[model samples]
Target chain A: MEATDRNNREGLKAWLNPSRYGAERISYWLQRLTGVGLLGYFIGHVYETSSLTQGPDAWAAMLELTQTPMGHMILLLVIGMSTFHSANGIRLIFTEGGKGLGKPGRPDYPYDAVSLNYRQKSGIWIALILAAAAMLFGASVLFGGE
Target chain B: MSETIEKLERLDKKRKEHEKKEIERSSIYLKIFRANRATGEQAHYDTVEVPVQRSTTVLDALLYAKGYKDHSIGIRYSCRMASCGSCGMKINGIPRLACYTKVSELYGDTITCEPLSNFPHIRDLATDFTQFFEHHKDMQPYIQNENADIKDPSKLSEFVQSPEDVDKFLQFSYCIKCGCCYSACPTVAMDTKFPGPQALAQAYRYFADSRDAATEERLELVDDRHGIFRCHFAGSCSTVCPKGVDPALGIQLLKGHMLGYSSNEKKIADLKERLMRK
Candidate 1:
């Protein structure tokens, strides 16, 4: 079927474009993307572990994949993504559940919404800092260790 | 004396040049998005040159284009002030009201004007708001008092509320229905069933209102999986709101009440009607 411009919605483009908005909006889809990525890694890890049923020969072959340089890099990324995903998810539980966000009041001029202010935005910064620290530690363990 | 006069002449020339730069009058091209569904015309941009001052708004430039350049250009506006909530569009990819946003506030030599996303496009820079209004209607924006009947025969009854009580819902009440928040919402872009920010905020406004009854039905209305739950609280809704109506806060607070985290109990303001026996 041919297409039409009738429904010209921004679709997922709107979700991906963080440059258009502020911290909270950017972290929203970043959190979701990392979550999906971690899930994929989790499934791959399970499949890799399933090789244990075939004894040392099969397990050793599967372990070879992780012993590769690419595998180490991916593992390091997973460590960071997982850390961020969990930390931000915990923050969202309180935010989406309607705590920490201040009660609505008169929005005086130069209107600052309590949701977009530093209190909520600071949570996003904390999550990023946690992710970076976790990734640094993972790099040391994966690459710097004997 | 002649050397001093010459120095003053040079300074005056410099002062005049400085004053000219201070006013900052320049011409900017408004690359307006043009669409024609009736003629099945594919969407495109038509660049129009508009002389602008520091005080010129997006609405002013668009009006100039329509007034002199092209009479066929489609644009919607009522009150030139921000109160009408008519002229809203995506100026440089951000959903904002054309009337309220001064051209000086925007950073660009070429301004791009497009119809708001998440709404069905009607024509150039104009989108269909029927569905948006319908979603708003579904929320039952007006007062839904159960005991609205007049119990007495002679005097009038006024639902008197304190300033503290008014503060709860007063912020959300300022929605101009401009749909800037709706356009800014990423969830609204993808999820059609989600009631969007405008409607959900109105729901919280009335639900939080001290005089309003019918809390159970209001809660049930926005309690669907596609309803309040769809809002991930990305907060683009709150950020894009031109009138300071924080729809994101309203939705989250509503979620709080829905999830039993916050108190749903409203004192149901005391009726100040005359109870005098004639």
Candidate 2:
């Protein structure tokens, strides 16, 4: 049993690389997806604003098009991805600052004095809910009781 | 003459009692597992028994075994006082200087010594430090000042630094580069690209040095995935350092520097929160 426990500990140690490759891989993909989406949104937003150069009539027409079903769905996806990416980024910052999820003796958190993982997890849930709310609000604002 | 002789006899007996002190002086038998390079296999153990004195260091006993019993039993030593840093090997499964460790510290009559882990063994105890030093050189461990006007033989005054600044990097400069910490570091063991704590700490030492001008250039080199970010702060490097230089602290400080304004803003917010709580 002692040998089994020792082997388990060693196995965990071997997996927990200082480079944090597992977490990093997750962060990398999330960042890439969010970045592309955000970039596309910015470009489209700028093009829509460029409708002002056409006339105030064209500008209002561009704003009216944003109230469509596809526009609402894209905005929701953007908000969800961006909020997740940013929240996880902040969590990464806290992870290095000695904040992590789980109990003290848990293999994931070997030396956490205060529980950060739960808080960060809670923050993620809150951020997601808030993002969903914001997307709904944004759609409503654009549509205006339509 | 007779009285003087009696006094001398009393002194001799007293001296013997004090030095010997009735401590259990037993023979500690060591079975060292060495990898023979010639055959490319694990070498058989050659057990050597040496009298364990109270103050007798492991290096002293190894030397005694080499000198008296078996001349072929390989071991390395220089500066028997632990200053030379050559006698670093695994003493009972931990990397330490043989010169500094007493034989009595071992729990049992038999203790093992082996070459440092994850390094090519040159002999029974000596692992080649060439790769370690090569990595050190790869970090560009010197001041790279772009300022051409600062050069003058006499005009170069003592680089005025604060007491706090001097205190910060003082411990890092004491690194003997014994490769004990490097051997113990898990990052260096797994990844070839990730520069180990010794080199990273050395990089931090120069980076923190007020006189060094090329901060961004040096930071840029080690700012990547396999660089300073690779340090998970396992803290084995700090534990094994003979000089007590905390490479873990240095690595964390370097991480703090790399993260920059976001962390600083968080710190400010945390401070404000603390003040409000107070």
Candidate 3:
């Protein structure tokens, strides 16, 4: 089929474009991206810490890289990704635990009722707020330290 | 040629012209996906203009294309209404019952119709729902009662249920098994083994039933790694449901039930005892 052929040509990366779906889909994609980003950063951080076994000079070189502009930008990105991932992770925990879902009602006409109630929506808003707040705090500490 | 033969040909030409004029008056453009199973041909979109009114649905448009324009256009629809659930397809980018969606509601001069996503397409606008039904069956979507009196035909009585008990699974009972929820689900698209939202929600429907005796078993069925946990609460399934069946909410409630955070066990037992007394 043309649809199957189109999917094969595009590969799984087609779903990575959050514009294809709604806000919830965009949030889902962002959560996955941030998770991957944090995992990558965790591995790199662990590897950098293990370089201390190579002696003081190697450790000094790793520390010196953090002083550069590029390293500072990378650290900022790490902070941002971690904050978003952690905040969103909390939201997922609550949803998976079924904390915010309201009582089930009859399926009425217009079919406008949604599963994500006000509580779930507020949880998502809270996650976004917390992530933004953490980013602002991290930026202040990073730039303020001369 | 004979004069009589020439006169008959003239009348035939006039009839054809009148029919053409009538067709032009009510024609609406339908961009439909088509494929042939016997010829080993690849699928492609075919644009057919057919006579339609403002209230013409996608199913009506498809039938017009099939009956007048082209007989090769494949579509599956049992009832013209939304009850049968056989006419489920993707109209534009959203999954919906083609019979329920009016042409006026759809934007653009030419309406686009395709088979439901996350299912094996049999042909144009018709997907194989075998897997969907299989998943639904795997959940054992029915009330289970082990009571001897309930089993005996002579002893069977009405199982009294409160309005509140009915409210638990009432929304979920509206599902027509359309596969629209499965198509709209991103998790089902990513992982085929997730059983999709339709089955999981129906599982919860049965689980929440006060008359059901297999609540523990039903809970265990959907508590697997790829079951309720696969749902990330995307909320797209509920958005596209024509009957307002909120499978997303049902899945979460099932999660809550499995986690021991919510239950109406005592209430159900009391209802059952009352019914038994009668």
Give the number of the best model, judged by DockQ. 1
Over the full model, what C-alpha lDDT does candidate 3 score relative to the true structure?
0.77
How well does candidate 1 score on lDDT at residue B208? Answer: 92
How do the candidates rank by DockQ, highest first?
1, 3, 2
Which residue pairs in candidate 2 have backbone atoms (N, alpha carbon, C) closer than 3 angstroms, thus clashing?
A: A100-A117, A101-A117
Clashes in candidate 2: how many?
Answer: 2
Residue B74 CA error for candidate 1 (Å)?
0.5
Candidate 2 lDDT by residue in tens digits, B1-278: 99779967876776666545434557888777555464455556778889878888888888888888877767777788767788888787667888877787667778788777656666577666766788789778876655423666555545567766566566677677777777666667667667788898888778777667667777787887788887754556666666666565566666666776224332454489799999
The C-alpha stretches of model 3 lying farther than 4 A from their native spots are A1-17, A143-145, B1-29, B50-53, B148-151, B264-278
Better of 1 and 2 by lDDT: 1
User: Arrange candidates by TM-score, highest first: which order?
Assistant: 1, 3, 2
Where is model 1 chain B poorest over a 10-residue stretch in terms of lDDT? B269-278
Q: Compare the candidates by lDDT and give the number of the best one.
A: 1
RMSD values, in order shown: 8.8, 17.4, 12.9
Worst lDDT window (10 residues) for model 3 chain A?
A: A5-14
Best by TM-score: 1
Where is model 1 more than 4 Å wrong at Cα?
Answer: A1-5, B1-25, B150-156, B267-278
Q: Fnat of the models, one by one?
A: 0.72, 0.00, 0.46
lDDT of 3 by residue, B61-166 (tens): 8888899889878889999889999999888867889999877666567888888878876777778787789999999988787652655788665787899989
**What interface root-mean-square deviation (Å) does model 2 yield?**
14.7
Candidate 2: Cα lDDT at B115? 78
CA lDDT of B232 in candidate 2? 58
- Kindly list the per-residue Cα lDDT of model 1 for residues B60-141, writing each as its tens digit: 9999999999999999999989998899999999999999877767766888999999888888988889889999999999
